[model samples]
Target: MLLLATVLLLVEAATAVSPTVRLQYASYEGTALANGVTQWLGLRFAAPPLGNLRFAAPQDPTPEYGVQQADEHGKICLSTAGGPPSNSSDEDCLFLDVYAPSNATRNSKLPVYFFIQGGGFNSNSNPNYNGSGLIMASDYNMIVVNFNYRVGPYGFLASEEVSKGGSINNGLKDQRKASQWVQKYISQFGGDPRHVTMGGASAGAQSVTLHVTAYGGRNDHLFSAVASESQSFPPLRNVSESQFSYNGLAIRAGCASSSDTLACLRNLSATDLQAVNINQPFPGAQQPPLYMYGPTLDYDFISDYTYRAYAQGKFIKVPAIYGDDTNEGTVFAPKNTSSYAESDTFLQNNFPDLTLAQLGKINELYPVEDTPSFPDSSRFWRQVSDVYGEIRYICPGIFVSQQYAKSNIPNWNYRWNVVDPEAAAEGTGVAHTVEVNAIWGPSNVNGNAPASYDPDGVNYPIVPLVQSYWTSFIRSYNPNTYRQRGAPTWEEFSGRNYNRRLMFQTNETEMEGIGRGQQGRCAYLVGIALGLKQ
Candidate 1:
């Protein structure tokens, strides 16, 4: 009788820790954590994009047999730079992870938060995100989902032949496939597809905005709301304009002499192809664009430039939260710049279509000025940073927010200003991606929070505060519904609100308005957005 009792206890513990969910494809057994969160990691949503499928849209995963253990993460997609080393990355990396309350059942129908990882559209950093913290922050009320997508040349390669083969913007298509997978299988995991909120940071944010205007604003009910942090709007070049890049890559890959370059590229070994997949300067440009390959003007999927799409009211009418960091350009700006001529050259290279007169006006608007906040950088560096910030990130976000307001869409805007002491000391105050730890909580940042985030435990409160607002927005669409106590109500960014935005800071969160000078600068840039190809 004693031996039988011990056996029964062990079986019960195994059943509790390994929870299984049956999907149309197969049964997946996920691990249940002590914090009441259950996670199914490295589950394949689409088939491996190999051989002919390279640079093509993702397809549904093949049916699997028996139960698969989803305890480990899948290999990340290959990247040109700043990603996992080549040995750790692969071409067959189209898996996703789902996190939900341990007690959640099929009938629970909880809200879902589908997050996209950002890495400048050239790398996949999905491994950095852990959804368990987000589930715990929601008090086990909602589910969180994140996934991996193809990046670099494997995803964004483009040319006339590639376009003819229907392979443009494969990276964006991978994101769509992930979202569609959620809509199809999330209900089986106790999530409501109707209440899904899509959120992303940086390039992921740009992907959200692009989906908002995808196929000329066709709403497929993929997501009901959006949360975009530090949205980026780089210039959208046409397929013909990208042919040079394709030619260059072909030459480097030893396929230059092939009669059918596209077929040759598709047949090359993944290792050989990856060797030549790297960023290169555009034609006649001194420096390369921050991102080598991005979404192109594929008349079918992308349709038009993002600015024109928003201007013409070609976007889904969804409640959204749009925001950016205080110094968005400091990280992307040219550091060696020291004079107005260098700044002008940088702008000209970035926007080669801009006329000299327009460049002069831009320089006049942002003259060389001392920024005490950045004492280490030269005055010209500050000027170029300011210009790049407005043109690339800040102004684009505000333009989208303004369009939403004009259409009476409920939306909230913000400027993240949380200071990191080390970054401040390095003269990059509140640089890009600093708010990620705050949103995901210190516990989820690879097991421990950086000293900059929880210094002496003084800045710990802001983590919960930031998580509360985000999870609240995920659950109820309105951030104030479940905001932390003493946290001020976040107002909508409407015309009557004077284009006000919440300033997210440590112990000083408040609302502020867009100044007239900044507004004028944005207006000038928006007027010439087409010429700049943005």
Candidate 2:
């Protein structure tokens, strides 16, 4: 009798430490952290994209036979950055992680935050994001989800044959599949499928925008709200235009001689193929953009340029929050540019189709000036950085918010200018993705929090304030309801005198407006958005 009691007690303790949930495919046992957050890491949401399934849309996961331990994260997807494959990275990477309050049950019906990580569509950087802090900050009122999707040529490869045999935009399709899985299975994890707020940063933010405007504004009822930071609108090349990339990769991979190149490419081992998965020069461009593999216009998944689609109001009418850091382009802009001619050359390299007249007009709009407002290593560097930031990150954010306001959709815009002491000292003031530490508390960030958000650091105070606003929006489409005390009310973007934005700073977060000069600059860019293929 004593032995039986001890065995029962051990089983009970094990069950308590590892909570299990059953879905259609399998039952997963999650780890219970000390902070009262239960996380199920690396739960497969779709089958591995391998063999003939390479470059194809994600398919449902095959059913499992028994309870599987979901303690460790899945391997990251192979990247086009070209490094040796390890146990941590593989082609069979299509898994997601979920974080929820340990005390919550299916009836909790908590709100959900489905976050996507950004890596310029070349690498999977989802490991950097941890949902524990966000869940704790929400006071256990919400669940957070983050996942890995295919990247690089494995995800975005396109060609005429690929269009006929497989689908384009496999990366975007992977995101959609993950969202659908949330809708079908989140309830089992104590989340409300109807209240999901999809969000991302950089390339991930661009993915959010694409999903909003996907299928020419067809709403799949996947998400009810959006939160995009530094949303990007790169040129959307047609599938035919991507044949250059396809042909180059195929030639390098020894598949050019095969009559069935697609099949030949698929038959190559992951390691052998990854050896040659590199970015090549795009057609008509001497140098490729930082991201060579990206969303292409396939007519089925993406019907038009994102800018044009938004102009036609071809986007889901959901409440949203759109924002960008002050110096979004410092990291991506060339530093050696010293003259107008060099800057013009830089522009041509990125947008090779730009006519000489357009280049001249752009130079006039952003003339070289040595002023405190545009401080950088050099005058021309600052000039080109401003131009790059506006065209690539800032203007797209403003344009999207303005379009949302024009359509009477409830949306808020903000500009992040909190000076990180380290970054400021390095002259990359409030550069791209610096706000991520503040958004996810220091405790939850993957590593030691940056000096900016350290306890005694410069930008530490705004952590809770930012967290509350985000959580409030996730819980109830409006950020103002549960905002931190004394935080200013974030006014909705309006089509009035000017589209106002909330400026986030160290201790002073306030509302501001889109100045007339910026408005004019963005107007010109939007006017030629189609010409730019954006």
Candidate 3:
């Protein structure tokens, strides 16, 4: 009789209550992401960025209790003006999403991988990052973390206007405080506080480098490993607003530039604040737009140049995995073409210091002559793939690794040469966000299908191999050196050897050896980057 009554009660409860459960977190909690993975979403790590909180260092999220629900993503820091669709945003948006194994309990202490999303430092979030395969497939229990922070002028506006303490890189401070929060509270969610690996792609990967280098010593005991995919190191160029002595939007909004205080700028609406970074006439300058709306040398967040910071050994010495794809420029290009003419007019306008002879030599060294011809359909794509890849990614990325490697740091490199042959025919090779989609499953890239699936519903088999190597690095700080049953041996980048880079592909998994000088114009560009006479 008792069993029957209990069954009846269970049925009644199932029908009466919502399928999801609500719980309050450290602060500003919510009900989002109650999918297959056990989720704790929108828990604040820092204080709301309203009024007084503006420009100040992040404040700890005061623990609060109440039956709060977290069944979906909360909000993003509203898009920078007329950028993209930014639904909900608030000063209280410094919240993180924690995804753990459904079977994981409070007692299961697992390694943690904190992902910093990439949007050229203007905006991003990890809630959109799917950990289904990385978590379930690895079987080695782990905690996945993603969060959101301020973007645009609200994030990286630096000037004398900050003297009143209402200026600087608030976005970077948000990340720092978020990391601190993870160190403090992740254990409750079954994460090993000490085994954290900070990882990201593009700008986020740059952030990992900056965090370790600029904000070193702060969390020496916290993060042990880092993986930076397409991470651009500092000394980045082409930030229109940043180059000027004052904030670009401030002047545009009729604020007096003569004033050296952030009072007027801080009072603007978040919408208006974001307008400063909107549709920034796509970076035509020498440098890639890694942080057009990102952290600057705020006395606290960034004290010096990021490259200098790393070179001085001021960064946390953590094992790192950093590399980029073969063609990352397709992410952004204006009618792609594989060639760029170094006109005398352009040289005079952009690099006035260079003589005609110098400019010619520069072009010759970083040659754009006699290149591969692309089909009419793929012409534009090839240009974007070549020029942009050289300037924006390949050169900078390799420079970063070589710089760190010179310092004897434990750094592993890979070139994601995997391209979908069909996609290549469509003019998009192993494109910019291809690896990202493959690693984390799918994103809203093509609309109908998930990010990883091709037209024929083919799933890339390389996904597991890449994920396994990544997770292994996250777990033991060692990328899987184990040769597959019939695969070739993966090698480390030793100076004794010229150039050895692993190619993570779809079917043909292998590593190739080549000459660093002959492979590409990386060494020549490095000289230009270091300011040595060509």
Candidate 4:
């Protein structure tokens, strides 16, 4: 009892420093911005999921006093080989950062804009996803939150045995745990627990949609609104279906020989775990396996297919904004395909469950030619690109929006058409991740636009325009009510306006409605996605 009491006392003594606001049992120090924004970096929301906690669900951090020096960015979860660049990766990396308005006293109550970074559910870093620039761009009274979550294998490993032994979706659960923590602690930062708005791009956007549809719309009141950019809801694998991936990874890591492989995995060093699992392509495989370290239907956090949940009205009903980029296929489109035979082989290999008849229909709908496709003569490759862009991005947005709109929920849709001339690949129009440049505005850290431009960088007019809509949306669930003069009144999506979308472009020098281009593309792709069930 003496030793236990001494340890507790030491912990309390280590973190007893005071700040403007105080957590339930701890205190934090943050950097004050020139504009009076108080910034906190690298705050722990949960205990480090290291050692035995590696693959386990996140546990709450010890709530004791210690001077939490939230000064520098924390380490990110180890990344996969193809993931975004990371400064460093470590098991002890579950942390969050925040930016609060200067006027945010402990008594102040401001709406919160929480963002999740996207890297195909494979990689993302808290430092790269700073919310300071977002605050600066919006210049609103809203508070912003940024954080790191596990990705790839350490975060998502699955099998029946593994599931029975513990649980899956550790990475996703990490986000939920962090949200729960926010509900408990954000008030200290002058953020209202009742008015949290969640948003993200790509995989991060996908996360937002999943949260909306999680447990059939079970609302913990953690969020009041959602915004997704280029969100995709691919079919998730069941534990039975995920076993092959788990076994293969275990065998490769030499954990299969152990009687308790899951335990063996937990015993292995984080580096060894990643060395064997990270970036190891399937042997002679076409597409990566569904259960290979991505979100799966664990039946815990996610009850069913996200689309099916939307279709069945099984998600939290909240106002939302969804958007995609035009020419999304150019960047992710398959390449080096010479003919239909090769394309057929690729699909058959990637989607083994797809029958030849269905594949043939898909091919018929997306016929290819030797026609030139921008910067190259490989026009035939558009077959795959067309389908990929629609299936993974465009259609998914329309699919979810249609379902939610039917329920009379206010939904907004958009297609970002602006492309950076020098940055784009030959023939590829506005590819993925372009809208992010517009949303966060230009940053010296990761600037994509050419140096020398107006306040919004080369993104100019479009950047400022987009920031207005986003900040407005964050402030009042609607982006159209308030904005700069001459800005197009953003339209709300509904069944009547199902086909229309806000088209953001540079040439038009203004946003416009896209009522006809690529008409029926999303409808056809939704059909294909639904047909997959049968």
Index of the highest-lDDT prediction: 2
Best by TM-score: 2
lDDT (Cα atoms) of all candidates against the true structure:
0.84, 0.86, 0.60, 0.72
For residues 69-179, write the lDDT of model 3, one tens digit per residue.
Answer: 554565776545444335666545777777776655445668899888777666663335656556754564677888887766656655555534664677777877888
Per-residue lDDT of model 4, residues 65-85, tens digit only: 767777887888776653332
TM-scores of the candidates are 0.93, 0.94, 0.81, 0.89
lDDT sort, best first: 2, 1, 4, 3
Minimum summed lDDT over a 10-residue window in model 1 is located at 9-18
Q: Estimate the TM-score for candidate 3.
A: 0.81
- What does candidate 2's lDDT look like per residue over 1-534, in tens digits? 999999886555343233798899989999888999999999999999998899899999999989999999998898886675688888989999999988777667889999988888888754636788888888889999999988888889999978887779999999999999999999878889999999998889999999999999999999999999889877888889988888988999999999989998899998888888887766777776677888899887898999989999999999999999998877877876778987877776666677889889989998886422334466677677777888888999999998999999999999998888777766667788677778888867676467869778878888888898989999899999889889999999976624899999979999998789988998897777789888
Clashing pairs in 4: 15-66, 15-67, 216-314, 217-315, 217-316
Residue-level error in angstroms, candidate 4, position 235: 2.2
Runs in model 1 deviating more than 4 A are: 1-18, 82-87, 373-376, 447-450, 455-457
Q: Over the stretch 329-393, how does candidate 1's per-residue lDDT look in tens digits? A: 88877877888888887876676677889989998889785454355667777688888888888
Model 2 reaches what TM-score against the true structure?
A: 0.94
Q: Report backbone clashes per prediction.
A: 0, 0, 15, 5
As for TM-score, the candidate ahead, 3 or 4, is 4
